[model samples]
Target chain A: MSEKGLLIVLSGPSGVGKGTVRQKMVESKLFEFQYSVSMTTRKPRPGEVDGEDYYFTTKDKFKEAIANGKMLEHAQYVDNFYGTPLTPVKKMLAEGHDVLLEIEVNGAMKVREKMPDGVFIFLTPPDLMELKDRITKRGTDAAAVIEKRMAQAKVEIMMMENYDYAVVNDKVENAVNRIKDIVSSEHVRVPRVIDNYRKMIKEN
Target chain B: MSEKGLLIVLSGPSGVGKGTVRQKMVESKLFEFQYSVSMTTRKPRPGEVDGEDYYFTTKDKFKEAIANGKMLEHAQYVDNFYGTPLTPVKKMLAEGHDVLLEIEVNGAMKVREKMPDGVFIFLTPPDLMELKDRITKRGTDAAAVIEKRMAQAKVEIMMMENYDYAVVNDKVENAVNRIKDIVSSEHVRVPRVIDNYRKMIKEN
Candidate 1:
């Protein structure tokens, strides 16, 4: 295939259901893409496959991989190293296979540095998405509680500025559908498919 | 709603089903947007009410409006003048209402010069969309036939480079669906929605 694979970087603030939305997208066969398997120091949870769910690794090996710059984006959560192997992801993309990377905000920022052209999507929190409704309900909520949420949403909005598209995680299925449309729309974008069309012209 | 509306401009080469796709999108109620009424000098057909379909006007009046620069984009087709009124479309967009404008490539280019921020979608021909398939069938058709089609497709692709998205008109329903997705995805784009979000933070 002459078409190059797009690196879809999906990230958002914590508790925005990034993992759940990603899982639903894969389950629904929303878009055809290979997952950039994350290598984690934590032991596999029940029913989690070795290479499918995650590449289970030891702390020392993970540290070595990080030291060697093999990870595309790596981070520690609860004393466990979680990262995406850079080479495998690059290999899949080169073969015209889109790679879906679900990383935390910090890790996504790192990926942005390495892959500036990637399609970066930010998932917005449901509460933050309903700011208009929340404004209408100002009389119901405590002033302190409302102020705290508004402050948190402000920070998330700042993080979202780094992304190209933002999807509200009000519903997982709806979010996946939006992403499916985005991927389809991206495929036909003149900038992405122009080269492939150009190749066809040249060959003939 | 505090959100500003988008100007969705759909155009393509002749015989690319641009009208069919636009009609389908409206029938499906795919996205909430006002239909931009086009002013024309052509006599209304049976059951085609003025203002609903077209604002029927005399040739002299149409020419005077065009001379005054009131038309956003106008074209003369078969001795009849057809053009869009600039004031209404701008009024709708200013009131936070999206407007869909299906125009010819030349008129679209004119609109682009005036409203560069509009979402411009180009409809590609089905034959051109399957350039790969046709490549395999290169031997089946006469060389001249193939060359002619390729030349036409090349012109269309060149026109497409001016658009933001290219949807192949293989199926009218599929094209409408893709457009629906694009509109939904476009709504949450950070650049479009960030100001509304910024307002929320400042208000509290």
Candidate 2:
């Protein structure tokens, strides 16, 4: 019996290397997952196309989608609304494709509440000192901004309790392999197999 | 921070390829686990060394171990006592090694009750007809004996509800790989990480 595809939510503290790890995992082709296109009210960044990097929408449109229950989960951050659209994810799962939602802590919690069957994974830094160093080495933000982000990291780390699994991004390869292993293993759960067994028994 | 190892118990109907699957899983070496040596009052078969195949014990010694609370779980089958020892498993976990226990359904249930930490895995054949075919092809038993075993198979398959994960043994290699993936994924449990974080917080 073919089981339904999984809904995997990947959440991490900022600069924990989840983006890179996810890229590597997707490259493996071991899983059939759609990388969700988030709907955002913010203008697209340079080289990022609307509906590709994100489904860029006007503030009014974003609000309408939320009101119409078109968004699975949404959160307002930095004065912009960002959310996961329900339609594409639902369509993908129905086609037996797993859906990967690369999101933050707040959005992950919201999705978990809506879909208890979803797999929630938290990507973590190896240690706080390493996390601080990594953020500083990025050189994108000023020292003050880096410090602020590190402080926020502590709060985010605390929220990891809400996740089903935690993988430390010590190395990109290891983290990606770990996530892939989780996806492969979760498919073997009892409910899925038992449902298949029941169906087989009925037919035979 | 290091994570704690899992206690995994695997059981299935006889001739469902449980042993072959488990053997292949151990050969993968992706997981660090000690195969639990059960204490048994039955005489060892040819080429079976004490403590290697099974821990040969006198009925009196088995009773004494039970009285001393040394047995994780025990049962009387065909006038012989068979049980899992508690001490070595605890020692293995304390040393950061996962433990794999292969036991009957009742033994698995009792271990779950006593430890409440072990992971129960139920392995099933692809279909009842295939299960019967495998039993007959093995040719170790007479036709009447094979029929009786097939009857017992149904009873065991019904016990799949007791397991945390149910894997279909359609192919030995696939089942083994799935088991390895499950063990690796379970290593990322929240409690294990939170424990590490708590200790680190205390140290700092």
Candidate 3:
């Protein structure tokens, strides 16, 4: 039996260094991970590549995909349809490439509903204070917006129980290594190996 | 919010190199692992040390421990009582040391029944041919005994589904590394980290 790849759903509160950790994981090339390119009806900003940053599409096309059940999980954000495409993820899994979907907790929950077997991981800062410090260091948001974000983070932290794994993003490299180890270990999980072993033993 | 150590129950079919992998892991010293020394009523062979190889004990004391629920799992082989003591495992876990229990599938199942949260891992050879080769090279068992073992191995292989993880013992070092990765990854599991995070977040 050929081994199938894992569908990993990674979610966290904003400013938890999810992007940085994910970037390090990608750069490490320790494991074959295919990032799920999302479909968005919103106009791409400068420097964003179509089908790379997102599957940029018109609102009509996005709605049509949604109607056809092509989207694994979808949400309308600020009047723009943002959703994960189902076809690409399935194709990648069939090719034995672990697919990572880095989305918000709400989107991840929706994906979990659609695919309950997927590994759901939550990334968090060392602590709430550290998280606030990171957000403050970004220097892009107003004080009021930062406060709103911190409030939202607290709510997300409360939902940590729903995840299968919680990785602390203390150091970018360390977090990347931990996630890599997790991905490697998951390949040898009993259910996956036993599926292949059953056939091998029967032949023997 | 202190992290408690994991009770890892490792089991495999015969000739899967569980002892060699366990030795490599212990020698690596990557993590604090306390091997669960079992109490046996059998006479110690050459080079065996008390408390290091086995806690050599009297049959009366072994039976008394079993009656008092001190034994995690016990089995009688060749009229000798072989059992794992639960007190030492509990003490080691309380001291924040990951405890590794290397036992047969039957004994591992008993440990699982007592401690359901413990991680149960199954080790296996690459294939039945490799397993037969390893058993043959041992030079201890006769052909008929080896054949009997192969039949027993088939029965044990069927129980792989009950394990949480399965590491294929192709190369001894590779299997040890995979098990180490699994141990490291399990430390960041959601339930364990969330318990710590809950306390940390509450203070913040």
Which candidate achieves the best TM-score against the true structure?
A: 3
**What value does DockQ give for candidate 1?**
0.42
Q: What level of docking quality does candidate 2 show?
A: medium
Q: Which of the two candidates, 1 or 3, achieves a greater lDDT against the reference?
A: 3
Q: What is the Cα-based lDDT of residue B91 in candidate 3?
A: 95
Off by over 4 Å in 2: B140-144, B201-204
lDDT of each: 0.83, 0.85, 0.89
* Candidate 2 local lDDT, residue B150: 77
Sort the predicted structures by TM-score, highest score first. Answer: 3, 2, 1
In order of appearance, the predictions have TM-scores of 0.82, 0.94, 0.97
Query: Model 3: residues >4 Å from true position, as ranges?
Result: none
TM-score between candidate 1 and the true structure: 0.82
Question: Lowest summed lDDT over 10 consecutive residues: which window, candidate 3 chain B?
Answer: B192-201
Docking class of 1: acceptable
lDDT of 2 by residue, A81-193 (tens): 98999999888877878999988888899898888888899999888889888988888899889889887888888888889898988998888888888988888877656
lDDT of 3 at B173: 83
Mind giving the per-residue lDDT tens digits that candidate 3 earns over B130-175?
9999999999999999999999998888999899998888898888
Best model per lDDT: 3
Full candidate order by lDDT, most accurate first: 3, 2, 1
